[model samples]
Target: MSKIGFYIANLVKRVQNYSRFKNVFLQRLPQRFHGAARLLFYHTFTADEKKLATEIESFRSRIPALTTDKEIYSYTSPHSNTFQTDEAGNALPGEYVGSAAEAHMKTGSSTFNGILLRRIVAGAGVKKILELGTNTGFSGSYFLSVPGTELVTIEGSDALCAIAKQNMDRFSDKHRIMNMLFDEAITQLLAEAETFDCVFIDGQHEQKATLHYTQRVLPMLKPGALIVHDDIYWSEDMHQGWQHMVQDPQFSETVDLFYKGICVVGNGSGTKAHYDIGEYLPRPEIFRKNW
Candidate 1:
């Protein structure tokens, strides 16, 4: 059944890819074919990037499957909830157990997203990193894999924080897991006068909070620091937040990878570059930012 599901997923992806090729590239044959140039420029991953992706996959395979520490079937009671689809019809699998050890939970970020995070950390040469969300330490494992880097992650749930701590024990003291609300954690960091070389903002997907963090984290980032916002197209609010970030003067440049939007703080000359990942196409700002 899993093999069949894999085959079906591949078939759907190929169809989607071809549809995008037609709609985005072939539609503008009479005009100045910008889509082809953009595709050629961004779609080709480098050799080193491919190798790193393979390594990330290998590391992910070794990670253990999540299991609850409590007695069986406690979470199967009446109040379990799950997020099946977003407004854009993007669906996610997996049953979300409640916020307890007895809930039989299996949830975290995707492997490809984890690879992207790891790549950003390595590519940007970030020494001090901050993550707004620590979901079961699945992504935390990738962050800890890099040498000479210190990671500080904030999680609102104590149960999830406990699980993340257990998962990140291999890193010992290199990583700090704070079980606190996003605002509270950022307040503490602000009081400490902490600055980060790279920051992954995956918490509070709403528009106001997203903009708030984008602005709030600027003072906490070193010059040329990489700031990444996850789930760019998760909703209207998220898209609006991403748009605000792209247009913000503080982040002089950006690279939009659909699932995640990456921005840099520097006096860079070029404009915001948009690259399509999965089925999402680049927005018109890519050209306007350049022009």
Candidate 2:
């Protein structure tokens, strides 16, 4: 593209972003309340929480660089080139497993969730991590950001496995991407008596699969290990599974962060209460919930 074309493109993008902001935030609030709303949001967090929140935003800002087209093709393994493109010559994103777009579901954990996981690993002394649904290694990258942390991620799609492997190539020694079904990976790990300090479930979103994973990982957790469930309210099925998990006799504590859920495996002695930190609310509680 020429310089004029680039300029025009950036201008168009700026207009789109501004329109989006107006429609999503400004349109709902009266002009007189807009400034007060901003003040209220900023006043909701402490200094330390604000700092952590900034860090999360910083990390999120860099994610697109890692998943850019240049980066994807750079490491995309020799898998089948079956992804389809629209009439506009744009490639469509892949959906989850079993869907026609299974190879394209590159959406990773949200920035909030990534920061939450990082805090869990750092605060919980988590060294060995197990992740289900290593879609293109986006979340895997975040998990491996902690020093000395090793991630064992299970992804069923061969294309996605290869993509994740390539995406996480820098952390060669820190991650192991398995190209197999979640159940198979769990069964094999169970047979090997493998254990993990922290576990993240994000791949399959079905109630039965979520419950099944909970059952399998229960015996594999170290005492007092932390289990994080992604997309707890993604669907009625997921919500049902999360409700059952919070009620399970195994977890001593359970927290509902709206976007994700966390459970602690132990004597089941804690209050077993459910706490909700709204998605729009700053998530300082995520850092403290491990206790």
Candidate 3:
């Protein structure tokens, strides 16, 4: 029965992917109906989107073997309510362990998600972006692909930060990489009175930390700014955190894409709403064989 469901889902995706009329219909639908459109339609990439995707993939291919082969330095990750507990059920600090390639493959956003990020920034005319996790700069590259955009990305591991800097250097000088914990970076930005058009929360996949960091960054977001949360369904705790966020009065609308979630700061609507589109869409593979 599950396999039958999977096949049916794939067939629906294929129809949506190749149907230009359906794409146009989805694009022309009223904003209020966007949730329904997103659930039933697959976005068709524009020429610019394809160009940026190509460039990002090209840059990814040229990554030096040394960089990809190196082992990531172990570092203490932020407290995660889901997995930070010890064998005795006491809470403890969690450490990161993986190779650079492994981290990029597992943690870095995929090309499909990157295209979605690019479309969001382009569609919203986002100028300034704050990214919580810089996993070798794969996703940051996508955000920076939009012309006249500026980014400030934060990463907890010094080793990963260094790698991200190297990768980001090929793209643009408009980005700043901060090798600090998520909270530290957010606090620094807040203290500087800085504001952003979009904030991408990709680090520290914990329920408590997700809510805390999001609340801390609210004051720094410009009016109508976007808040994107990655790995929303990573765990029961993370999903609960997403649910809590969507219910908050601070956001006017929230979209749940299973792998990631997005919240809009204001929509001029007094009521809050949540959209679940993951079930209708297929999850993109984490790694591309061509790259």
Best by TM-score: 3
> Where does candidate 3 clash, by residue pair?
none
TM-score against native, each model? 0.64, 0.61, 0.77
Count clashes in each candidate, considering only residues at least 3 apart in sequence or on different chains. 0, 3, 0
Instruction: Give the clashing pairs for model 2.
Output: 94-104, 94-105, 95-101
10 residues in a row with least lDDT, candidate 1: 72-81
Candidate 3 residue lDDT tens string, 129-167:
999889778888888877889999988777778767777
- Model 2, 141-251: lDDT tens digits are 667866888999987666567667765665446788887766778778999999998789885565666676788788889657878898776666567778898888788
Candidate 1 per-residue lDDT over residues 1-291, each given as its tens digit: 355774566455556666665676445332222332333324444475466445544433333444444432211111112324446432222233454332323445655666567666766677888998786676777677667888899876666676677666655469988877666677789999999988888865655666666777788986578888877766665676688877777775566666578788765454443334434332322211111
Most accurate candidate by lDDT: 3
**lDDT of candidate 2 vs native?**
0.61
- The clash tally of candidate 3 reads 0
